[model samples]
Target: MRIEIIAVGTELLLGQIANTNAQWISKELAHYGANIYHHSVVGDNLPRVVEAFEQSRKRSDVVIVSGGLGPTEDDLTREAACEVFEDELLEHSPTMNKIIDFFKKNNRQMTMNNRKQSHVLKTAMVLENSEGMAPGQIVEADDSTFIFLPGVPAEMKSLMNDFVFKYLTEKYQLETKIKSEMLRFIGIGESTLEEKLKDLISKQTNPTIAPLAGEGDVAIRLTASGKNPEREIADMKTSILERVGHYYFGSDSITIEEAVQDLLVQKSLTVGSAESLTGGKFIERIIQLTGASSICQGGLVAYTPEAKQRVIRVPKEIITRHGTISSKCAEEMAVQAQKLLHVDIAISFTGVAGPSSSEGHEPGLVYIGIKVKDAPAEVFHYYFDGSRDKIRQRTVNKGFELLFHKLK
Candidate 1:
């Protein structure tokens, strides 16, 4: 079924509130194999709302509208629907009684405008709202189904779960299901990953492959529509992993830090960090997850040469010879951190994240060090381009990326 979602609110257009209702509705409908062709946002003006409804009714098999259903004067969605469908407005007696009971139960005086919530289309099926005062409505005309829901997120979700899902299933006889899976990767660029999977992407039909660039990583989303799509999706994932599996970290909703935490718990290993440019951000991410106290040994933010020498005890001679942004300094910091914090693994970050040069070195020049117990320290160098915050954020992600591979 071709479905179009329309959001009615002046706040959405004015950037006062987000139009999250449409996003949630689209996700829910797509699971039942419904095609969402367009999303529209119209202000609270009556004429514009009528126009939006008229356009959607002509082209779409299903029209789902959210917002503009309240007791205030700006609530024009009910009136607009009546105009577009050429239906009469009538008072829903059951809904009116419910509203009156709610006010009496709360011992509050009912205003004249509150009665507006009880009015709905004459030919529409009334959906009683248990969460709020305004009721939802469903109108069927000329082979089109129109659903009007509340703008409040909690009320809208409650109605969808309580009544809408089962109703749609019974009326449309929904059978085929749409499923999507995400494959997350680090230590690889988006362009390179796409080039590696060009052949499979070109030959795609059922399950389409889409590559998306995230904050500091890359992801591939696979979407399939069928009665049973798990096997086909697994096969496609296996094919993609065969070519670029080394760069793959985890799947949907799994952050790199969480992946590292899982690996650490499995291996029964403890970790620590010594920060210079990242300022404890690397370890901060680790402790954000639950049960981190079991694996984290804490970290030190040695932002300057003096702090590195005094707190983490990086040798003063190394800093004097190679400076703080060098591989030698980073390696020393990691080795010292492992010794002081008594962890199985230690990582260090030392970089010049700036818009200006430091110590005759250009901005975005960074070195990261990793040292495992009884093993020689390894240092990696990178040069990034962006603002100071971006450079520092990327440094933290790269630390997790390196740790993920080492733990594997």
Candidate 2:
């Protein structure tokens, strides 16, 4: 099917926020093997929207539109549908009742303008919006289907997932569906990861390999269209990971922190931390995951040398001899935190993360220390370039990555 996404709103044209609906819809429709040719953004003008609809009707079999379905005067999707499909507007009582009851439950007055949202095309099948006030519509005319959806992302997604997808699949008798497996990696740059998988990516056919880069992490998305698609994608992913398995941390939307948490639980080991540059960010990320309370003892934000000495009980001599940002101080902090918090393992981050240097060390200079119970403590040095937040985020991600490998 030739599908076109029309995003309606003057707000989108004015750059108030991104037209995320188009991006999300395109991805969702791709699962059903949709051929999306054109994506358009139209302002809240009646003539332009109608013209846009008519032009799309000439070429595309399916026209999916989002936005401009609201109570305000700018809401003109139903009006455009009436004009384009030559259908009269009909009052949908069930939708109005839902909207009225929503206002009653919320203890708000139902303005008369809200009635504008309760109307549907006369010959259209109503796409009910359970999450929001505006009801969506599926109007068919002249052998083409016009899907009128609310601009709000949540509303559009709900309608699409619940109704539109099933309808499209059943009507078109779709046989193939897109499936994807995302292989996540840390402690590697996108360029390095791409180079490692260059042959697999270049010579792929059934499942195409695509690389994605994010802050502190990179991913290879393996996508394919076929019967038993997930299994095929998984087989491709396993082949790719065989060569770079050490860098591959987890897969399919798993975060690096989640991977570390799983490793800690599997080993039944507890953890704690002492932080300087990241200021408890490492511990914070760990504790955010569910079941963290069982494995995470706690952490101390020992930003100052005095705090490191007094809180985590890092020896003052190490700080004096090697400076607070040195590897010696990092090792001492980890060793002391393990003893102080009484966890199986302790991690420490000490760095000069800044727009400027500190203690004669340049910005982005960092040291990560790890102390495993009944083992020797060690510290790793690194230099990262970015803003303070980026450097701190890198520190946290690197700490988890190192911890995962150490536990493994």
Candidate 3:
């Protein structure tokens, strides 16, 4: 079914509050095979809201409105909805009792203005709000469905999960199950990955491929529709992995830190890092994953030439000769960190992440080093294009990517 979202809040237009509710609703609705065609943001003005509702009813099967459902004077979602449908507002007894009980439990006095929270359209179905005072409304008019939800995120989420989803499932009698899988890839750009799988993407049918670029990585989603959700998801995953397995690092909801943690546990290895341009971002990510203390020995942020020489003990002569952004300096940093931390593996990152060059090297020039027992310390050089923060993020990911493959 085609759906449109209307976010009603004057604060959104003033940039005082973000419309996160609309984004969350869109994602949740997509799971039920509903297509979100458009998103509209309207102030608390009744006229504008009524106009938006009229426009949405013409092109969408479902129109979901969020916000402006409080007891305050500016809360006008119900009024606007009633005006659009030409219906009268009436008090819902159950909603009124809930609101009174909430105020009583909190030891607060209920004012006459609070009665407004219990009002609903005469022809609409009342949706119980377990988390907040303002209940939601669902109305069917002229073959179109209108859902009015509270602006509060927790209340809206509770109503959608407890009532709206089930009601829509029974009302529409939807049969086809939609399933999706996310394949995470590092060490490759989105454009390059798309070019490699262009042939498969062009001929997609039941299983479609979409690539999304994210911070320091790319994700490819494979979605399929069928009667049996399990079978459809299995088929889609198989088809995608067959073509992109080499670049794939993990599956849905699995991050690089989790994959690295699993690998370290399996290999019984400890790790340490000596970072320069990335400023210990790699180590910070590693430690954020639970159980990291089992494998992470320590880390050092050797950002300056003096810090590298004093902390990690990179030789002064080497830094003076090759400069801090050189591959040789990165290798020495990794080797020194390995010995200092007494870990099985150590990784280092040294680079120029800036709008200008450093030591005759251009910006976005990075060198990653990996040191492991029985193997010589290795360094890899790369040149990237982006802002300073993006370059630093890329350098950190490259460090982890190189270490992951080396250990594997």
Candidate 4:
């Protein structure tokens, strides 16, 4: 199926915020084996929106539009859709009653403007929006299907996941199932990983390989389309893993922190951390997982030399002799954290993540320390190049990568 995404807003053109809706929609539709050829952004201008709708309807089988389904004057997506489909706007009573009940429940006055949200195309199937006030509409006109959704991302996603996907599946009776696996790799650059798999990528026909660069790591998305493509996909995955399996940590939507926590839980081992450059971000990521409290002992964010000495009990002499950014300080911090938290493993992060040099050391200079139970502490050094946030993020990722390997 040929699908086109149209995002309606002026703020997108003005660079106020990104059109993340289109990106998200395209990825979701790709799972259904839909071919998304065009993504368009149109300001809240009626004529242009109408033109975008017309163009999409002419070339695409399904047109998914986000935004401009509000109560305000500039919200004109439904209006423009009416013109293209030659449909009349009629008020949906259930949506109007829901809006009224919402205002009454909130103890607020209901304005006439809000009534605009209850309108839909005369010949459209109203998709109830559980997250917001505006009800979505699915209108079939001529040969094209138009799905109008509220611009609010949460509402749009809820409708798409809850209703539209099932509707599309039933209507099309899709025979070919599209399956994808995301193989995540760290400690490797995107270009280097691509170069390593260039032969497989070039010779790909059924199961295609695409390398995607992320914040602190890279991923390869392997997609296959067929009634039964599992064995072929698994074979291709085995081939790729044979070459670069050492750098592979986890799979689709699995963060490094989640991977570390899973390993800890499986081994029944507890972990703790003493963070400097990354602050409490290391433990913060771990605690975001559901069962993290069982594996995560504690964390300490000792930013200054004084804090290191007082809070986490890093020896003052090490800071005075080697400074806070040195391997000695990092090892001391990890060893101290292991003693303080009484965990099976401890990690420390000390780095100069800055836009300027600190203590005669350049930015991105980092030292990570790992101390396992009844074992000597090990320290690693690295230098990364990026903004302060990027350097800090990389430091945290490297910490997880090291821990992942150690736990393995």
Candidate 5:
């Protein structure tokens, strides 16, 4: 089914809030084999919303709208929907009782405006909202389905997952369930990764290949539609693994830090870091995952030359000669951190992440170092292009990438 999303909020248009609801809805709908052709953002104006609804109805069989479903004067989603469908609004007694019960349970007073949330169009099927006061609605008119959800993310998600998805799935008798697998790749540019897998992508049929680029990483999503979700997922996994097994790190929700943490636990290894331009970002990411103390020995933010010399014990002479931005300095930093923290492995980042050159080195020049037991310290250099924060983020990911390869 061709679906379109209309997000109604002046705050979204003014950039006060991001329209993440549209993105989330599109993703969820795609799982049921719905094609999202258009995403429109209309301010909280009735005429513009009606025009948007008219346009969406022309091309889309399903129109899902989010926002403006609040207990306030500016909230006009229900009224606009009623106007479009030529339906009259009526109070839903069950919904009204639920809203009243919610206020009573919380020991809060219900104002007269709160009663507006109980109004639903006569032709609409009220979708219960257990999370919030505003209930969602699903209506059919002119052979097109319109689902109106609350602007709040938690309420919208609950309604969609609990009611809307099941309703559509049953109504359509959807035989083929769409499954997607995301293959995460680092240490490679998106263009280069696409070039390597160009042939597989060109001949794609059942499982479609889509490449998305993110900060310092590339994600290739493989989607397949079939009656059996397990079989479809297996086929997608096998096909993608055959093509990009070497570069693939993890799937879907698995992050690089989680993968690194799994590896650390598997090998019974402890890790330490000496940060320069990254400023302890590497360790920060590691610790964000739980059970970090089991694997993370310690971390030192050696941002300055004095910090490097004092904390990690990088030799004063080495900093004076290599100037804290060289591969030699990175190597010594890692080695010194390993000795100081007494960890199984040590990673170091030394870089000039700035708008100007540092120690005769240009900005965005980074050196990532890794030192392991019974192995010589190794350093890798990278020349990135972006702001200071971007360069630092690049260095942080590069540090993890290097350590991942070393552990492998």
Candidate 6:
């Protein structure tokens, strides 16, 4: 089905609140093989919402709307849907009584404005909200389905989980299903990866390979449509891994940090880090995961020269000879961190992230170091171009890439 999602609120346009509902809904619908063609955001005005509805009806088989369901005067989604479907606004008596009971149960007064929420399309299917006051609605007209949900994220999610997902599955049983699998990679540029997969990409038919590179990350999505959808997806993943398996770190919805955590748990290894340029970002990322205290030993923020020498105990002579941004300093820091934090493995970062050069080194110059028990220390160098924040962030990102290889 060609689904178009409409988010109705002035707050979304004004950036008062993020339209996270559309993102969540799109990912959920993808599992059911639904084609989400477009997303429309409208203000809390009746005329604009009606115009948006008119446009959506022309190009889509399903229109799912979120927000603009409340007791306030600006909540006009119900009126707009009624106008588009050519139906009269009628009071749902049970809904009104439920609202009255809700106020009495809470020991509060129910104003007449609250009764407005009880009005809905005359021929709509009522989806009683378990989390909020307004009831969700569904209407069918001219072979198209329209679903209206509250703007609140929790209410919309509950309604979908409890009623909407099941309804869609039973109502529309199409023959073919389209499934997509995302392969996430790091430490490799998109252009280089594409060059390696050019022949396979050009010959794509049943399973199409699309490379997505944005927001400082690269991903490849293999979409296949057939009877045996899951099996085909697995085969595609295996084929792609045969070519670029070393760079592949995770799959759909798995972050690099989570992948590392899984690896550490499997090997029963604990880790620590010494930071110079990344601050505590890498350490904080590890601690954010549940049960991290068991596997994550500790960390040290060695921002200053004295801190590095005194805390992590990187020798002052190494800093004097090769400077703080050198590979030698990074290796020493990691080796010392393993002793200081008493971990099975230690990671260290030293970089020059600046608008101007630091210690005669250009901006974005970084060295990431790693030292594992009874193994020689290793260091990797990289140069990234962007703002200071981007450089620091990329330093941490590259550190993860280097560490992944060692874990294997």
How many clashes does the backbone of model 6 have?
0
- In the predicted model 3, the residue pairs found to clash are none
lDDT of 2: 0.90
Spell out the clash pairs found in candidate 6.
none
Local distance difference test, each candidate:
0.92, 0.90, 0.88, 0.91, 0.87, 0.89
Model 3 residue 115 distance off true place after TM-score fit, in angstroms: 2.3
Query: For residues 127-191, what per-residue lDDT tens digits would candidate 1 score against the true structure?
Result: 88889988889999986999999899988888888888888888888888888899999989999
**Model 4 ranges with Cα > 4 A deviation:** 9-31, 66-75, 78-173, 315-317
Question: lDDT per residue, candidate 2, 1-408, as tens digits?
Answer: 788999999999999989999999988887887768999999999999999999999999999999888989988878887888888987899998998898999999889999989888889998789889888899887868999999888999999999999999998888888877888988788999889889888898878899999888899988888767788888888888787888888888899889888888999999999999998899989889999998999998989889888887878888888999998999988998898899999999999899888999999999999999989999999998999999998888889889988988
For every model shown, the clashing-pair count is: 0, 1, 0, 0, 0, 0
Highest TM-score: give the candidate number: 1
Question: How much RMSD separates candidate 4 from the native structure?
Answer: 4.2
Per-residue accuracy of model 5 over 1-408 as CA lDDT, tens digit each: 788899999999999999999999888886777668899999989988888887888888889999988989889888888788888999999989998988899999989999999998899988989898788999988778999999999999999999988988888766666777888987788998888888888988777889999876789887777766557667766766786666677888888888889988999999999998888899999989999999998898978899889998989999888789998999999898898889989999998998899888899889999999758998889898999888988888878887776666
Instruction: Write one digit per residue (lDDT tens) for candidate 3, span 1-408.
Output: 888999999999999989999999988876677778999899988889889988999999999999988999999988988888999999999989988988899999999999999999999999989898888999999869999999999999999999998888898876666777888988788999888888878988767789999886799888776676567657766766787666678888988778778889999999999999999899999999889999999899988999999999999999999999998999999999999999999999999998888898899999999999757899999997899999998888777777766666
Tens-place lDDT per residue, model 6, 1-408, is: 889899999999999999999999987877777778999899999999999999999999989999998999999999998889889888889889999999999999889999999998999999999998899999988868999999999999999998888888778875567788899988678998898889989988868899988454589998887777788878778888898988888888887878788889999999999999899899998999999988899899988888888888988999899989999999999999898889999999998989899999999999988999989999989998999999998888877777776787
Each prediction's TM-score against the native?
0.97, 0.86, 0.91, 0.80, 0.87, 0.89
TM-score of 6: 0.89
Which residue ranges in model 3 land beyond 4 Å of their true spot? Answer: 97-109
In candidate 6, residue 56 scores what lDDT? 94
- Candidate ordering by lDDT (highest first): 1, 4, 2, 6, 3, 5
> Which sections of candidate 2 miss by over 4 Å?
11-31, 35-39, 82-135, 141-143, 152-163
Q: Against the correct fold, how does model 2 do in TM-score?
A: 0.86
Regions of candidate 5 where Cα sits further than 4 Å from its true position: 18-35, 69-71, 91-115, 126-135, 153-163
Assess the local accuracy of residue 309 in candidate 2 as a C-alpha lDDT between 0 and 100.
85
